[model samples]
Target: MIYVVEDDKSIRNLIEYALSEKSYQVKTFADGLDIVDVVRENAPELIILDIMLPGKDGIEILNEIREFSDIPIILLTARTDEFDKVMGLESGADDYITKPFSVLELLSRVKAILRRSAKKDTDHINYNNISLNTKKRTVKVDGKLIDLTYKEFEMLLFLMNNIGNVITREDFLLKIWGYDYEGETRTVDVHIASLRSKLLDAGKLIKTVRNLGYKFGEI
Candidate 1:
């Protein structure tokens, strides 16, 4: 299910119409407060949120939802200011669309976010002696808990989720980091190294793929 929070009725209708035409299940709420519970109850595949709304704004709602879920978020930015974009990214939004965005652009972003999330859930990929409790964003190895940053855990999960398949650094930047982060390839390598080192007993589960990048090996 796809949920949208937009105060503008016409714009909301347009988004609902466009995505629904493509056979996507869509629900819209005029205020963030109206549909906040829907997130917990329905678990949307993707969320389209407007930056300005009645009662609770997008940023507040984003923070609220993030307290409990990592559902992919696409912020409908109200301005072209770079700061707003940066703030939104820092707030855990998966993508952003500036005001007056074309329907084609919105559809493109929706497709990319959905595809990236789909790759993540392809299979139940767990580390040896380590498990990714999606509900908790945690990793445990040998019954000892390991601490990992949000992106660190995501990168580890992405590689492990793909198992033997080699995932390129570019894919990680685009999928896990967002396209706006500007070429953090080296960062991906660094995080993988750190996560592996911490895994200790289960470290062998992560493997370097020569020039390709990294992969998760089976136990």
Candidate 2:
């Protein structure tokens, strides 16, 4: 199921109609008032959200949703400003489409994100004292379970998968955030710091290359 959160009646109905034609189960919302709660109770496969709304705005809603779920979200914005786009992505939107976008293009983006989201890795990864179960989406350090956010988990898994290789921030944003954009390298740094902290002594396995990116395993 997909959730469409757009205040504009015409746009909301249009999205609902297009998604319905694709055989997608959709629920439309004129505002983000109850979206967080609804998502907690019955999370949808994806969400098409507008940045400008009557209350709580889309960014706030995005943050709230990211707290417990990494459900794919596509931001619907009429703003052409790069700041809004970057902010939305940093806040955990999988993708964004500007207003007056082609319905076909929107449908294509939806299908692509869904396809990526459906992928599952059933292998277990063990690096040093860290154990990760991709299929279970759980991480343990030194035999103690440690909680990690979605991005942190993915980042750690990717680094461990490529141990000893330098991974650039741009590569992380592309592979993890699912987008290629500038001025968001700090986002990677922030998540890396948090992940390192959560891993305790095992965190030392993540090495920082002064002028490059980050590498996992040994100094």
Candidate 3:
């Protein structure tokens, strides 16, 4: 299911019409208040949020939702400023689209995100004594559970998915932080450090490739 949260009636109706026509189950909202309750009842697969709303703006709602859910979110707003986009991504949005967007473009992005998420739904990765359940988003090493933040879990998942292969910091920034992310490579280093600390003995599986990048699964 998809949730569309926009204050404008016409825009909400148009988005609903377009998505419903494509056979997607959708629900529309005119404010942020009701969404909090609705999500508690049943969370949608993806959310389309408008930055400008009656109150509690989109960023606030996005941050609140990230507290318990990692559901994909696409920000739809008229704010074309680079700072707004960066802030939205930093706030946990999976993608961003400025106002006056094409419905076709929106639909395509929705499909792509859902498709990628679905591909990762059922698969589990295991190497030596470490186990990662993608669907449950759980990690365990030597029969001990590890608590990881969203980004930390994703960073570890990406590396384990391509065991024995080197991945550059630039690639990590693009894939994990979104293509538009303006953050430096240092962000990757920081997250990797945290992830390694949590992984305990399994952390040694990840190795620095000497000016190239990072590689997982032994040297």
TM-score of each: 0.58, 0.58, 0.58
Ranking by lDDT: 2, 3, 1
Q: Write the per-residue lDDT of candidate 2 for residues 114-159, one digit (tens) a residue.
A: 8887763235666555668888889876447899999999999999
Per-residue lDDT of 73-170 in model 3, one digit per residue for the tens? 99998987999999999999999999899999999999998887676645656565566888888997754689999999988999998988999998
| TM-score (C-alpha) between model 1 and the true structure | 0.58
Candidate 2 Cα RMSD (Å) = 15.4
Give the residue spans of candidate 1 off by over 4 A. 123-219
Q: What C-alpha lDDT do the candidate models reach, one value each? A: 0.81, 0.88, 0.85
Check candidate 2 and list the clashing pairs.
none
User: RMSD, each candidate, Å?
Assistant: 13.6, 15.4, 14.9
Best candidate, lDDT: 2
Candidate 3 has which clashing residue pairs, if any? none
